[model samples]
Target chain A: MHRVRLGIVGCGIAARELHFPALVQLTDKFEITAVTSRRRERAEDFASMVKDALGYEPAVFDSYEELLESGSVDAVDLTLPIELNVPFIFKAVEKGVHVICEKPISTDIENGKKVVELSTNTDKVIYIAENYRHDFRFNKIRAFIDENTIGRPIFVAWHLWIGMDKSNKYVQTEWRQRPKHIGGFLSDGGVHHIAALRVIFGDIAWVSGVTKRVSDYLGDDDTLSTVFEFNSGVVGNYTVSYAVSGKQYFEIVGTDGRIYLDEERITVRGQREETINIPNQNTFKNEFEDFYRVVKHGEPNILGHPVDALKDLSFFEAAIKSKDTRIEIEDLLRSTTPD
Target chain B: MHRVRLGIVGCGIAARELHFPALVQLTDKFEITAVTSRRRERAEDFASMVKDALGYEPAVFDSYEELLESGSVDAVDLTLPIELNVPFIFKAVEKGVHVICEKPISTDIENGKKVVELSTNTDKVIYIAENYRHDFRFNKIRAFIDENTIGRPIFVAWHLWIGMDKSNKYVQTEWRQRPKHIGGFLSDGGVHHIAALRVIFGDIAWVSGVTKRVSDYLGDDDTLSTVFEFNSGVVGNYTVSYAVSGKQYFEIVGTDGRIYLDEERITVRGQREETINIPNQNTFKNEFEDFYRVVKHGEPNILGHPVDALKDLSFFEAAIKSKDTRIEIEDLLRSTTPD
Candidate 1:
């Protein structure tokens, strides 16, 4: 019956398009108590929008620390750009505030390890908002696999290709094109597939990959091909390309059948083929609802726990290292010391 | 229409399971005039089965050369073990007989090139029987791509895994376990996927691969992971493993949509997703029918030509070389010289 007061950092596209809409929809469960942005004008504009949209007024801050220090807020949603986001997560955790941070979790292993270490000492929850797992279509794929509809997955092939809107001014201004800011495509985008793979195939033991810069205009790579060996002994290959021109699709191949998920539907094929139309469930809304349920009831398995986030961060770090050194990622995962 | 008289060499599982049954069903278009095997009893048994199955009598030969020299057969179906099959194909082409050899076409570059050269001089057709292209589901995928349902393909990820059958008598055989006989797993089983890739994504310009023999008892590799770059700038990652305990499946990812095909059906996903139930059309039967059509009428553009077979053979050869030297495969189509 009690509502959790929330603070949101980063008033960018993700916050504007996903978090704002989701927070407005889950009004009964969560109250948007505070908002912050690097730019004070944007923060004021967002606060006004939230006031008009959700019918409540909350404190607005020009900095994340101000929002974290605000006594009215229960949790912080760190949707800030990666370079700022990593340090912000550590600060929020140290302040004894539960944090739900956007993914990659941290762009590199050192910072990621620090976040993991910080979570162990803190009673406040640290959850990574990896919405792909919460996305109902992908959840159905995991469900079908667990129910033995596919009868023990032996191979998983994922293809994610999202075209950039060249005409969008916001995209042109974003830090996504810079390796220093985003850790390149594999770290930012590939982490989703890696996290999804972990959820579907279990622990990944080793990986090998090649990253290539397709266009001279971008300093970082837009394409990647990676192979992963799961602890279950199943091998998976993933192809991620920002240069590719279309929608996303994925397939999970198992002993008895296969499950194919795309933009619009999910299909399971075995002794008989069945196609299921997935109704448009706003994944961001679902993710926030799950987060709300977990926080309200002390449920540990909602959204993705800190440990799950750490694993995905580890894999992302490993992929970047493998690409950089041109060494098999198996070496990185098995190494006793940091590369 | 004049029926094409056919002779089958090797009388092995391929002949018994695929070729013989296909010939029986298409009796109006094909006539089985002779059969041969290394063992006289096996040859006699096949000849009897062909006669009983089609209600037509065919001569039995103890030696392959005897069948080739018989002068009664118009074409030779080389369905023997891959090693014997390669040499038989060369001899068949030398005898000016059209050939439909079960794949790999030949295990090594030297023999495969020889078959290609022999085909150029003789007016007889040489089809490698790459049945996956003829597979109804793949054809549907091709149609979807042609229709621009998925738009232009930018990346393709294929997973082909066949579990080693413990009870399979063929595994007990010696040649299959030896690298020289079948060129290991990449050349033996992987050729099918590689050939399929060529059919979907143009000619491969280069490839980099890692191969591993997971089972200590097996002399040949059970797993192979490869990345190929096609001439059209489309890049692909392929994983072919006999070590994985599961079924076979593949997907073609394009800019606008995707087509995923497995054992049971084909699913095309674009702005929307639709699953097309493939009624278990026998790929071998369809392949033979195409071969029958090519022989009776003429080679059509879509139903694979001799050049396509040669290109597939070249890619297989390059994959083997790349695996052995740990080098990237380059310029397969241009080189007439064998490695």
Candidate 2:
């Protein structure tokens, strides 16, 4: 098996905390050849962190195009700010380099559409790094619904509420605190949960929401409570808050029973209460490895396809739209389980 | 304090199961004088049931007019079908007797406005039997919020999903199966949770919803997912279904913490998750005793005010209207705490 030489774009926070550790676990499948960031020292620091974590030093590029022209990379791992993805993705595809970009390909639908369209037109494969879809606990619950463990799913509730203070790391990032993208916290963090819903329940058909700015530091909607109708014909309710302290929880109700996911512990209440199995999974590694398989052996894309990622992005885009328009977003029967 | 002699109307299912037992518990504050039903046998059965539950027999009336005109009652507890309340309430008030009718006063805003108007015109007091307002667990949570145990109440979510099978007792009733109310199951059961929100938060300023009939036997909207914006400046979301099996649960999320209410337990997630006290008090008895105090000592109504009940019903009416019109119901900033 040939190892795809990977160039890491955007050596920012996630590149250090998440992707580098995940890449170290897949030494057999991928070779980290180069890294890029506008801040050359952070780019060098990312290389040092990678070498410290795993005994290897990758080339560091101060500019994204320099890595593309260096021809030392066969694929690109994009972890840039959301709105910064389209041009890099377009350039990667034009260079015949396979690309794996972060969730929410773009913050807005127009830019997301361009990336999806251009990536589809090219032969180079593109994948979305939506780790929740790859997370084991979520997929296990999805299997329960799919296998009729809990009868047909009818309702879903997902709440993610956490306070943002000066001490918090994301609050220190300028792009997150006041993003050029429409929904700041909502787009950056909310995309994962919405992607989980899209992965589990098919696709969102329509949405209506009540979104507000509960935080002073956040420039856009920091709190959003939305009701969604899945294309599978189930109603799912979700509330995402970056200004409150109700950690996180997701519950799914079906005809036969209910699956309550309080953080990692899952309680399935059917004829009786049962604790379902929770497998140890590194979702970032799982996401990267799945992308590796698609690039290596051409394994059919399961939940990692960029089109599948676009569905959630579009739904979230619609959530912001619904908040702005003060109306339920209808006529949004986007393709489900993209082939 | 003088004990109010109370006439009980409508010897239906709830009359036998709920109110009679509650009346037994409040023997000192309320003296049962007469029981009425359209059917004489049911009325007699109710009197016998009350006698069995307590240690005395009350007079039986075949008609509401007989209960009102018999002069055997100073106040009446009307537990008739929801739409049956307005005329009976007017008759009770015309007789200069205090009346406490079952929520919502009426299913529609038009009939509800008439009841609220006529009750205000006369001097005799009118109360709506919104027992959930008197419910101990709900009130405990409310007090927690009011005392700043939880910070500012910013969001609320309530979900009730239960299948209505033929074996169910409520399914045996014709009114619930083919309800004349615009929101059938929503008005019948959803009003309770709605009232809980309206009481804890202030008056609802606006609402939007997606309602559907998930049950074939039920005539109106058996499923409803609604978002309410309170004039108190909070966003509340609710989803109720009579077609799935996730019993009933509601969570109130504040700026600092959250309080979760399942069927029998109350969990407050603040500084720590202590299953807050679930004091066992009969909501019906508390409702009746509150009305008794309001009537005898001229005490201020806590949750007994008809206008308060009217506010919940109107928000619900707007929910149904929002469903039918395919729009958000706005400009509904009715009175918060009624005079």
Candidate 3:
């Protein structure tokens, strides 16, 4: 079996901290062949780091197009800012290269649908790197729900409250400070939460939400309180705030029992109580492995499909727009999907 | 201080288990002089218990009307079922007796408003015993919010998930099994949550909610997920479930800090973290003391006001009824208030 040659796009903190560490562990399935960034020095630094980890020096391209057209790589790993995702995804897929782009597919529904439409016109996999979908704890939770371990999930309450101060690396980014997207961090970090919910409860059917700007630095809306009704007959309250720090937990309550998830623990309360300490998982690595398998082994695309990321974008956009009325997720998609 | 002569109505579990024990502690402030129940034996048993505690035997009346008219009490403590609350309240107030009734004031908005109207026509205090208002933990929370301990309040998430099984005394009652009111236990027990929120914030400006029947035994709708917008510019998600047992916690997130409340503790995270061990106070006793002061000492009514309880009922009803649309709490109140 031959390894899939990969190029890294956008050599910012996510590329350096998250993706590079993950790529180091997948030397057998994936190899870093080329890299590109707006800042050529950062791309050079990334290439050097890749050589340090993989014992090879890859070409550093001046632009994403150069990386896509040079044929030095079979696929490109996109870690670009949110707004740049669509054009790069389209370029990679149209250029006949498998691509795993960072979430979301796009910041809004229209561009997300456009990317989805473009993916179907080709055989090259347009995988999305929504790492939350690959996180093992949610898989454990999904298995619990699938096995009736909690006696049918009736309700869910998920809260993500963290203070994104100046010291935080993500908070220091220019795009995040003045987000060009609809809901700022709500679309950026919030999509991961949506992806996790989709993994555990299926697609969201409808949503009603209220957004607040508790912190001026977090952009348009730093806080969102939303009620989502899933197609699987489960309703949940999901609130995400980048404004102030508080408890971060996701709880699912069922007829006979309840399941709770925090950052590092899973507590299941049924006839007997069980608390599982969730081990640290490199989610980016897991997603990359899935992307590699889908591209190389012709494995089925479940976790990395662009459509799943599109749905996540749709839910977040609908939540931002749903102030006083409930927005049906399917209707939002139908309206936004290009003919 | 002269002990206010109090008549006990409806000798059910709440009256026997809750009010009786409280009355024992308040012998100097309130004297149980007359008792009446649908069951003559329960009323006689209550009188004997009062005699054993207060060192005097009180008259046992065959009917609430007889007890009111016999001049055996200056104020009546009504511990009847939900449907009986409005009528008994009207009878006692019209008979010129100050009454402390169990929440809610009524099952529906129309009846609740009628009781509110009847209270305005006389000087006899119509106190609604919503013990959550008297619960000191909420007062501590209210103080924290008022002191800006958490800065300007941004959001709140309150979850109440408890199983009402056969062994639970309240679940064994015939009325609870076959509830005639709207939302059943939602209004029966959910009003306390609304009361706690009102105490912390202010009046709920509007509400959007979805209710589910997770347990067949808990009544029409055993689960509720609601987004409440307070008039004071705070928005919150308050979900209550009587179908399953999970964590019962109320969290308030503000611009500067956050306050967390569980069943046994209050955790405040701000410039300095504070964990308050919430000592148990007999909330019933606290409310009785307030009732005694209001009836005998001409003290102001705040905690036990009937209007406050009516608001609790209205909020719960609106949440239950607001399925596809948002319900403005003030509009609901205005529509129900009789001219």
Indicate the DockQ of the complex predicted as candidate 2.
0.15
| Cα lDDT computed for each candidate against the true fold | 0.70, 0.77, 0.82
Candidates 1 and 3 compared by lDDT, better number = 3
lDDT of 3: 0.82
Which candidate number has the best DockQ? 2
Show where candidate 3 strays beyond 4 Å.
A31-33, A39-41, A48-57, A71-73, A254-258, A267-276, A326-339, B1-3, B55-57, B147-153, B254-258, B273-275, B326-339
**What shift in Å separates residue B238 of candidate 3 from its native position after superposition?**
2.7
* TM-score of candidate 2 to 2 decimals: 0.86
How well is each residue in A1-339 modelled by candidate 3, as lDDT tens digits? 499999999998888999989988988888889999999999999888887888999899999888888998899989988999988888888788888888878867777777777777889899989999988888889988788888888888998887787578898898888787768888888889889988899887767678888777766778888776887779889988887776686889887688899877999887557899999889999989888889988998889888788788777766655564533222222233222
Candidate 2 lDDT by residue in tens digits, B1-339 = 478999989888777787878878888888889988888998888788777877789998878887788998989988887878888888999998999888877867667767777766987889988888887776677777888767788898887776677568877787777677658777777778877776677677767777776667766767888776777778877888876655676778888778888876888777556685576778888888888888998987667777777677766666655544331211111111112
The top-ranked prediction according to lDDT is: 3
Task: Categorize the docking of model 3.
Answer: incorrect
Query: Tens digit of lDDT per residue, candidate 2, span A63-112?
Result: 88889999999899998888788888888988889999887777666677
Give candidate 1's chain B TM-score: 0.87
For candidate 1, lDDT tens digit of each residue in B94-183?
A: 787888888776666556556656666777778888887776665577677778887767677766666676455556656676657444
Model 3 pairs in collision: none
